[model samples]
Target: MKILVADDSRVMRQIVIRTLRQAGFDDHEIVEAPDGAAAKDSVASENPDLVLSDWNMPNMSGIELLHALRASGNTVPFAFVTSECSDEMIAKAEAGGALFLISKPFTAETFRDRLSDILG
Candidate 1:
């Protein structure tokens, strides 16, 4: 599986990749995007199987990415790996066709648990 990981912070992107490996998803290919606009371009050019994005980002937000993908008739699975987990954000994510909203400060186990159904 090819996974596109989008985040503005380089450190946070590394953490996400490390967590994915620790969660036993090390076999997949990972494509990194510095922000949501780059993420959109990656989606177009890379054809990733899944997208894991930060909710707040420069150029475009995760929710905006999801909406854009949907509007453009792309159905690639999308999810958020973000710090904010407000009910409103969760609702927006769900409504935008996200598969999951994983709060930050997460553990490897959290990724495994939340991803099992979709990635399995």
Candidate 2:
């Protein structure tokens, strides 16, 4: 499985990757995107199995990326791993077809619980 981790902060992306590994998802290929726009491009070129993106990004926002992918008839599974997890953002993410919104400060257990079925 190919997982795309998108975040403006390089450290955060690395952290996410580390968490994925710690969650026992270390065997799969990992892709990194600095922002949502890059993530969109990666989706088209790499055809990742899943996308984990930040909510606020430079070129495009995570929600916008989701909308764009869906509008383009791409059904790749998408999720948000962001710090801005307000009620409104959660609603928007769900309505825009995100599989789930994982707030910041999450643990490996959280990733395992949310992604076991999908990643497996």
Q: Could you tally the backbone clashes for each prediction? A: 0, 0
Give the Cα lDDT of each candidate.
0.94, 0.94
Residue ranges of candidate 2 with Cα displaced over 4 Å: none
TM-score of each: 0.97, 0.98
Clashing pairs in 2: none
lDDT of 1 by residue, 1-120 (tens): 999999999999999999999998888899999999999999999999999999999999999999999999999999999999999999999999998799999999999999877667
Query: Ten-residue segment with the worst summed lDDT in candidate 2?
Result: 82-91
Q: After superposition, how far is residue 25 of candidate 2 from its true place, in Å?
A: 0.3
TM-score of model 1 (CA atoms): 0.97
